[model samples]
Target chain A: MADTAKIDYKNIFYPPGGILLWIIIYLELLTFGIALVFMALNARTEPEVFHESRMLLNTAYGAINTVFLLSSGWCMAQSVHFLKTENFGKSKLFLKLTLLGGILFLALKSVEYYDKVEAGLTVGYNVFFGYYWTLTLFHVIHVIVGIVILLVLGRTLSKKPETLKVEDYESGAAFWHMCDLIWLLLFPIIYLLF
Target chain B: MERTFNATWLVLIVLTIISAVFANLDFAYAALIILGLSFLKFIGVAFFFMELKRANVFWRVLLVAFVVLLLTVVWAV
Candidate 1:
């Protein structure tokens, strides 16, 4: 039998794998959930106030963003699968595709914000708008951070194709997916509920 | 072998589409129904696509507990 007792202790805590990374990703998710609960409770108490303010939102824009995030998550998952199989070239391609999705989401969000401003529906418009913009924008910022991480990871993977990149890529993808999952809740609450 | 087209995903998608269609119906609890369906879809995705079904028992319990807590809060509010 092969003796499997000689394990390296120095690198165990921050394993070359993604366990620590996932812990951080899940921590962010927990924070997002807490924020969501706080906002939802505030909205529940003032349905009419929130509804009137929610009218300022563009459902089409929200829907497009949702699609963008979902597709980006799919791309990220595909990239992880490719990386697991050592197909670094295909993995890079999928990562770039995912990055494009993130870029498109941000561009659409900017246009939506511009339209909201033109329609005189600023954050001060109402409490609902306040919460809506705050939550979505916070999620947008997370998306931007996620994209930056992906871009960096992409650059690294392209340079060192043989390195164990799957864990980092999967952790980043999980974080982005959490962002999308939150928005899926936020969209109907802030836009369609009214 | 794990199947490619998850029946859970298909069922959840159908439920979601139905819920969306029902949202247009002039019913008193249509919104509640939609929200419930959305929650169900969330569970389906979490368990299947996210591979939570294969997670450790403690993690699975934690997820269910959190979900129940959220639902309770929603109901209370």
Candidate 2:
């Protein structure tokens, strides 16, 4: 097979769902990137506080969450591909797999948060943990939104195929991918960097 | 798309694990190296998995710009 770059998605302006979706995605990506840069800059002021708090984090847990999100993004991408091909059953199967990944991601993230709370290291503990909890908890909200969108998409696929186009499915898929994209950026920023 | 997306996933996983290893290294540029690898992973997901490869140049330019700004900030800070 040729590279994906060679496979045309038809129009640049009319990507899967609509141009507006891409706009939202672009803004979302930029917003998260800026927030991350802000965190990085803030870390520079009190490097020790950030470092000490960062060390308390379980890199393994973050790594696991990374894997889960990555897997879910993969599944969601596959689902959209199958949906475009009009392979309804395969699409749904992959959608369910994506949902499974989302569930696991939330579960692991919950455990990580619980550890912090139990240790009296909540967001109020310090600036680093503040950004940590704020960013991660916001991401959790996004994942929850993604899951709900997927459920709505699932219902659409099963009950009313005619009401939605493949591009509409792509909108939801893109949102899920956005969550994955944000996490991809967030992981190294919080877990690996000083 | 399926084959390419699968290849993209493979690259993402490999880069992630490699960066995790880089974090354990005591090298001076480990942070930069990890960030660079992660940038590659970001490209993989955006281009292949997210289908931005075939997307219009608008998305490509905007996203690449976002990466540049992110890198600049992280590098400077």
Candidate 3:
């Protein structure tokens, strides 16, 4: 008998990002997840040191950072939404707004780190500060990457307009959202969980 | 969609503000409460902003499970 296999189109789910993108996301999350777990376990050892060091860090700044990222996330979503609706101008505008958010986040984060280093609290200062700097700096690197991705998207949209696929826009947005998710885990862990 | 996004954004901001205010509280479960709220914010971002609300079962479940795993491991520690 001939093969009667049929492709199940409706059952296939390729998230906004390509499948490989999700795999990369999973790996990134796992890397951070292990770090977070180590931090938490280590925190249980010297709660006092961790809490004291954590207090040196600014909760308000972390909150502000969260707000900025969340707002930027909203902007990215809007950019994609407008793009889907075929409103190129609005999409471009929102993408710019999203990039601005990333810029502001990096700026504020740098100031926060500056205060820490100036206070003589480097990553090796203690276990908590170690994780504090390590985890947050790693996240900072991801944010930088996320911003660069957005800029590339912006460039493509501007220079080659109409050559961009919706998936291309969403691929960048999904990665940006991954950044948001990582921070959401980190904010409470490093800044608040104490 | 605009209104939905705006309202969700407002709610997320409110949650963050609430968490910040509760930062220095001297309660035993304060951390849990704050983490819970942050998780809620994550939910909003993932579902609404990331367009995961209509995602197939696997992706949605996987994301939620990941969040839960983080919460559980953190709480355990």
Best by DockQ: 2
Number of backbone collisions per candidate:
0, 0, 0
Task: State every prediction's TM-score relative to the real structure.
Answer: 0.80, 0.94, 0.94
Q: Which stretches of candidate 1 lie over 4 Å from their true place?
A: A1-19, B1-26
In model 3, which regions exceed 4 Å deviation? Answer: A1-12
- Model 1 over residues B17-77: C-alpha lDDT tens digits? 5654654567877667666765775565555544455555555566567655764565456
Inter-residue clash pairs, candidate 2: none
* Model 3: per-residue Cα lDDT over B1-77, one tens digit each: 98888998999999989888777899888888888998899899888887777656687788889888988888888
lDDT of 3 by residue, A78-144 (tens): 9988877778889999999999999999999999989988999998899988888888899999999
Name the TM-score of candidate 3: 0.94
Considering chain A alone, what is the TM-score of candidate 2?
0.92
Q: Rank the candidates by TM-score, best first.
A: 3, 2, 1
lDDT of 1 by residue, A48-77 (tens): 886667665666676667667666666666
What lDDT does each candidate get?
A: 0.65, 0.84, 0.85
Model 1: pairs clashing at backbone N, Cα or C within 3 Å: none
The DockQ score of candidate 1 comes to 0.27
